[model samples]
Each structure stands twice: as C-alpha cells, then as structure tokens.
Target: MPVTPGGKASDGTRADAGALAGVEECEEAPDVSLEALGSVATTTDASPGTVVPGSPAGTPAGPVSGTSPDREAAGTGSGRDTPVERLEDPGNSATERGTGRPGVAEKTLEQALPSVLADGPPKVLAELARAPQRSRAVRRDGLRRMGIATGLVALLAVVFCAVQVLRPLPGPALVMTGAPSYTIAGAPLTPAWPGEGEAAVEVEGVGSLGAYGDQKPIPTGSMAKVMTAYVVLQDHPLKNGDDGPVIAVDAQTAKESTAPGESTAVVAEGQRFTERQMLQLMLIPSGNNIARLLSRWDAGSDAAFLGRMSGAARQLGMNDTTYTDPSGLDAGTRSTAVDQIRLARAAMQDPTFSAVVAMPRVTIAGVGQIDNNNTDLVDPGVIGIKTGSTSAAGGNLMWAAQQTVGGSKQLILGVVMAQHSAGASDYGLAKALAVSQKLINQVRKALTCTTVVHRGEVVGYLDDGVGGRAPVVAGADLTVIGWPGQSTQLTLSAPVTGLPHRAKAGTTVGTIALRTGQAAGTEVPVVLQHDMTTPGLSQRIARLR
Candidate 1:
C-alpha cells in the first residue's frame, strides 16, 4: 500500500493499514514526530526518492515507493531499492508555497531572508498590552502646563492692580488774587489840619492815607446826590460816551423844584433830557429838583428810588451811609468820610460819571448853563466833583485831582465833612475847599510811582524736584504807587510740588503778588523762562537731594 502527499491512498481506495504503519514508527521516535515539525512526509507520483522544495537539506527524500526509511531502518518494510534526489533551496520553497505551482520554484535569498527575520507583528502585539500607562503620562503633562500658564496670568493681574493703587495723582496749579505793591525811599509828610469834621484821602491804586475825628455818620447834605446818580445809572446803564435814553420831565417834578431853599435847574413839564445831560445837570449844579426828578423817573416814585439808593450803598460796602432823600435835603441823610470815599471810588468807575463830574459847568434846553458849585474846581489840578453846604451839615466836599508824581499822573480823591466857618461873616465852603486842597497836595508830594518788575526778568526760581532749578519770570512790566518809606512784600503761588517736567516756555505756571501797606495788592503773571525737559531716570535718582 502506498500513500499520497496529502495522506490519502495512492490507488484512490481506503488504505488505513499503510497510514497506521507510519503512526507506530512516529510514536517510537516521539522527538522527531511529524506533529512536532508541523507537517508529515508524503509520497507523490514522481520519480523515486525525489526531494520537494522547503524540505530540510541532507534529510531523507520524500516517501519512497517500496520501503520507507523509518520502516527500512526498523526492518519492518518490503525490500526495494529507491534512489534519493537532492532538496531544493529554501527561497524556492517559499516561492512554491506563495504561488502554489506544481514544479516551477525560483526566488532570491534576499526575499527568503525577510520572511525568516520578520518580528514586527509580535512587537506590535507587545506594545498594545502597555498602552494605558503611556496615555496617562501624556494627560498629566498637559495638565501641568495648563496650571503653570493659569498661575502666571493670575500673578500678572495682581501686579497690575497693586501698581495702580500705589501710584500718585497730580495736584492743582497755583492761583493769585488782588493787586501788586510798591516801596518808597523816605517817610511820607503828613497833611495840615484845617477842617473841624472828619476828612480822608485815598489814592486810586494805593490805600487810604489817614482819617481824622470819629467815623460816626454826619449829615451828607447834597453829597447824597452822588448816590442818586449812581442808582440811576445802574438801573439804566450808560457806557462812557453814550447819550443814553431820553427822560421826560413831569408837572409834579417842576412843582417840587419851587420848594424853598432847594437847588433847581427849574426843569418844567414836557422838557426832554438825555441821561448824560440829566447826570451833568444834577451832579454839576447839585440840583435837588433834578435829583428828585431822576429818582421819580427811575422808580416811579421818590421813596422807591431812595430804597434802591440804600441797597446800592450796601453793595458798594458803605455800611455807615444812610439815604433819607435823593437830594440829601433831609437832616437824617448822613454818611462818614470813609463810606463816602468808597462811594466816590465806585461812581468814578463809570466813564459817563467821571466825564460829567469833572466839568465846571453845563447847559440844558429848558434852563441856561449853570456853574458847578464846587469852588475848588479852579484850584490847580482840581477836577469837578460835588459840594454841599447847610447850617446843620456844615460844608461837605468830595473832590478828585490829577497830579504828576514820578512822571505818572496820580488821581487823588479826598472828602471833608462838617467843616465850619471861622466867623459869621464867612461860609463853610471856603474851609472845605481849603482842607481838600491841602490834603491833595500832601498825597501828591508823598506818593511816588515805580516799576517794580520788568517784563522777562527772572522774578524767582522753580524747583524741578531733582535738585535742579528753572527760572520763573514776569510776563509783563508791573508798576505801583505808594507813600514814601513804605515796605513792599512779594508773595508766590504755585503747585505744591513745583511744576511738572517738559513744561513749555511761555506757559503761565504761577503768579507774583506785590503788597504795599494795608491795601489790596496787585498780581502779575509768572511763566517759565525756557523749556524744561524731563530728567533721565539715573539723573533723577542721583540728584535726589
């Protein structure tokens, strides 16, 4: 019995007996059994002892037709001589398996070597078993990076908030009020006394010289007309050269002008006058009737007009002044020289009043030109103001004069009240005029005007906070007038820690105020003389002192 390569019978019939013969032999040699080599040897219909590809070299050829090698060695097979053939190459064996060819078998050694050395599949299987631990390590690294980034952002946010809270805020710039001051070289000469009542003198830009007697209110007489004109102008404002609105005279005002001992322009009903013309008539001639007429025209009644006059007095800071009548005819109408000086200063600020009061005389349509009753108008440098006279009020004069002192025109305003006549033969007007003239002369001689600060001159220095200094200069020339031998003081106003860096030249940073005596001082603008640049960090730190 013969078997095929697939272990089937060669005659195409059952042959269990021949298959059992090799089984017993394989059992006897267990180490070299067909199962251990993963295949069994078989006989094919080829020539006897022919070797197949992939068979081990130097081993017995495939199954012999007559007797098998194992059976022959064991002396258990029928005797028959079979020739053996050499085995084919291993590369040819792999080619034969891949192609399933019956006889053709050819391949290179390089091709067979790869199949014998391949271990990729096994290595990939080993790595797959340990994948869980590697994945966990990657996840942990990502989380650590994210934590570090979040912590860095939070630290930067805290640092920003701290810097904002600790930084300093800038302060406000400086400011100045009032006027400048001047100094004199010698003691001022005092004026001679010639009046029986209170008298005082005041320079326009300077302070009051002195006052005599009590400051109690005395009869103002016709000086009350000054307030009358002031209130009228306030209600109907008139500029310096304006003719102002027309005011018609009423029949009732004409009747009042005929009152006994009252000064009158004798204005009749239906007469028309401009505001400027009416002011001249009332102020120049000291007309009581014209004053009352203006009062009635302004407030619709003399009483209401007097109320406005009292309010105007308080507004001008004249606390001691009282107005009982527009014309000052009432004995109750009284004021002090100090209060009158304040009133005079305010009234003269109006250009129309300043022009009208200085005139010696003026004419009207209804009445001929009347002379100003102020007798001192003829005196040297004497300007026309008002004059008042009565037995009870004595004589009162509010006068202004312009005199050259240190080559500048000085406007001197003086007032004398309750000046009485020496005897029954003379009038108190003479005493009032004499006293006012003497006082004006004394001020004109004692006071002098001087230029205190020149434009672009360095008035002082500004600290730059790092031990460096910058020049502070006046923006313009400043001049002031004061009595001889008076002391002048300079006050500076600026920022608390000086000016900031990079301040431009010509920028106003502060002010220089000059004070003389007890008067309100004047102020001049202070500016940087040159551009101030910011100091370097090292320079600022080094010059900390």
Candidate 2:
C-alpha cells in the first residue's frame, strides 16, 4: 500500500499519484440496493443531529466521508443523520440484512404478517396501511352519527311525557238537574181557603199552601204597624232579652191616651219605656199613639219614619203595599193578604218582635196593665205577629203558628185581610183572629211528616263515561215537613275539579237540596254510598276538557 500527499492508501501508506484513474482504495457497499428501502422507525443509542428532516428517506442511516460544512450546519452532519419515523410506510432494512438490529415495533408487525408473501412484507404492509385507517374513520363517524340520533329521539320522548303530565284536565259533568222527586208518596195537600175577604197562608220553608179570594190592595188597619215596628227595629235592633234603649213619651202622644175612636197606650208626659216595653205597647196592645211616638222617636219625625216604612215594604217585595200613617189609622194605608203575609213572615223572624207579640198581657211600671188585642195568643200554637183594625181599615191579622210533627217543627204563616166589615176595631180584630187561626189549623193538617230521602237510598248516579257509575245517596234520613202529593226536587253536584278518584263509602261528594217550590227546603248531603273510583291513566288523559 502507498500513501499520497493528501490521501491514504489501503496499507496506511502515502500514495504518490497526482493523476487520476489509478486503482482506487474503495470498499464495496453491502452487495444490495438501499436507496429503494424505507427509512428506519427505531431510535439509536447515540445522540442525533439538532435538526430533523422534513420527510423520511427510503434508506437506512450511515456515515459519509464527503459532506460539506454547509450540510453539517444544516444538521445533515453525516450520512448518519437521524431518520424521521414513518407511520405511513414501514421498513424491513433490518429484516433484509442480518447486520442491523430491527426495532421492537417493526419486528412485531413483520412477525404478524403471512409468510406466503412472494414480494416480501414491506410493500404489502405499505399498501394496506391507508385501507384500515379509512375503515376505522368511517366506523367512528357512523357510531357518532348513531349516538346523536339516539339522543335526539330520547329528548323528544321526554318532552312528550312532560306535555302529557303538565296539561290541564276538566272534571266530570253535572247530572242532577230536573231529576224526579226523591221523596216518598203522600196524599195531596188541599188546605181549604177562607170563605170571606182575601186570605193567603204559607208553610214556612214550603210553598204557599193556598191563595184565596180576590187578591187586591185593601186597608190593613194596625196590621200595617208591623212595618212600622220592623223599620224601627231595623233602625235600632234589639235581640231577645235585650230591653233596648229607653224611649220618652212626649206630651202629644200621652194626650192621645184619652183620644176617642183610637187605641192608645196609657203613657204620662215625660214617661220613658224601654224599647222592648214600647214595642210591647205598640204591638200587643195595638196602640196607635205608641206607633206615632215610635215614628217620631226612631226617625226624628213622623214623615221620615213613614218614608222608611214605605221603602222597607218595597225592599221586601211588597209592591202592593202603600204606607200612609205609621199607626194604620189612615184609611189610605193599604196592603193585600199576600203583602201582609210577606210582612208576617219577615217580622216573625225577629226574636224580639216574636217574643213581644207572643205575650198576651204585660204589666208596666206606670201603666197598671195592658192586654194583647189579638185574643188568639192564648193558644200555644197561635203566635202573635200583629192585629190591626179601624173604622176605615177593616180587620187584618198577620199571624204565625207552629206545630211539631215527627220531631220537626213546621211554621204556618197566614194573613186574613178585609175580614168582616169596616167598623169598630173590636169586631174587626175578632174576625181577623178567628179566620187566621182557622187557616193555620188547615195548614197544620195538610203538613204531613214526610221523608224526602232515606239513608243508603240512591238519590242519583255518577256516570264515569265508560259505562260505569257509583251511587250517590243520602247521608241520613232527610225528614222534611212538606205537603202531600208535592214533588221535592233533588240536586246532586261535585266540585269543578271533578269527583275524587277514590272515596270512602260515606264521602260527601255534593249537597242534595229538596226544593218544594221557589223556596229551598231541607239540604242533606249526598254521599258516595259505594266506594267511588277514578278512571285509568289512559282514560284520564283522554278527558282533557
């Protein structure tokens, strides 16, 4: 071997050739093509260059003797520049040459492939890399789309459920109107009417028993004082047992005690009486003077009190009545039998008025004693309301009587107006009392103790709209004092929320009122005799009205 001046020979000797084309000391590369192979994916133990290549080379790394300084600065300092890893294409440079070590990743992928490949594993591996990736991408996209569709369907189902639960639903229909009477059968109540004058009587809470004679406005005598008393009590009310405010008797009213042709309470000038005592004087004794004094006391003046009385009459639906004098002394003061009965009904409701009028006689501190003009009060059933009579105003009596039958009291109110002839009050009042008592007795006889509904009896039915129903029945035996042959109408109802789905046997679903006429009679609770049930979920949802 020889060495040149700047070159070495194969024997480590200097070569003296300055000319080219001599036998060059060259070593041969592996007896194989490396340029056609893929770059190595494994890392080396030695440190790599500072910069990485943009794309991987299709050749393994090796040392280079002929590299420029610029190439070294660009980080390709030697042919052994660090090889960039390639996922897209794998290499078999180690597998093809026994001289290099393969990476764990490369060896595992190569071992898994079939050994029957004639072209070796690298090319086939490269070809199949993108196919599996596309398949995986398509499968992932399909799963994502399915999940989104499933979530949307679930959201719609939830919204649909919320709408069904939140919407309002209406209750059941009312089915108790115009239904037949629920009472037991009884004989017809044909109470006879008064033969003379005009008369009308009503069984309290029941319809009018009868209306007799020509109905027209006529003089009501002291019976019109009932209005005066009612107006006074309204202005200054006194409950039963309350003596009420004191009232002074003026000289004019006291002087009238001796007045002829007129009834008067014996009161002295400057004398005072409790309101109850004064009312007794005005009502029981039928004192025209007391009535006048009351008008003055209650309303500052007689005219104002008279206006109040007229207004009260109008309010009570007594359109047929007209008030002239508070004492009924004026013949101009007039009312019909029906109108007087209206006053009797309302006046009897006052405890003080009824208590005062019921007394047959009362003793006073100043006046020795006074007697009720209506002698019929001696009878227990004949309750005194008022009795009025004058030369112009015929005998008129507004009376209330009650009778107990089957543990229930029945009140009968009757008015007999224009009784007898217009003359002295003695005979007129006597006639009024006699006729009113007779009418009351007739009503008592006609009032039959009747059971409108029996406990456990079906008053009506609650239809569930699905061919099912529960019986709504009386909670107790409803015994009402109604006339015979009169039908008692029954009413059954529930709340706007409809009947409850489940109820006990005795749950009060609604009220059953037996109306005898325009008047509302005894009200008994209509209960669920059987356990009531509600509709199913589907049926309830369907009933959205």
My TM-score estimates for the predictions, one after another, are 0.62, 0.66
Query: Tens-digit lDDT track for model 2 on 126-243?
Result: 4444456666899999999999999999999778656655665444443553355655466676756656778888887877777887878888888878898899889999864789
For candidate 2, the lDDT comes to: 0.68
Give the residue spans of candidate 2 off by over 4 A.
Answer: 1-167, 174-179, 182-186, 421-427, 464-468, 495-498, 517-519, 537-545
Report the CA-based lDDT of candidate 1 relative to the real structure. Answer: 0.68
In model 1, which residue pairs have backbone atoms overlapping below 3 Å?
Answer: 179-521, 179-522, 180-521, 180-522, 181-514
Local accuracy by lDDT, each model: 0.68, 0.68
TM-score of 2: 0.66
Give RMSD (Å) of candidate 1 vs. truth.
20.2
Q: After superposition, how far is residue 509 of candidate 1 from its true place, in Å?
A: 4.1
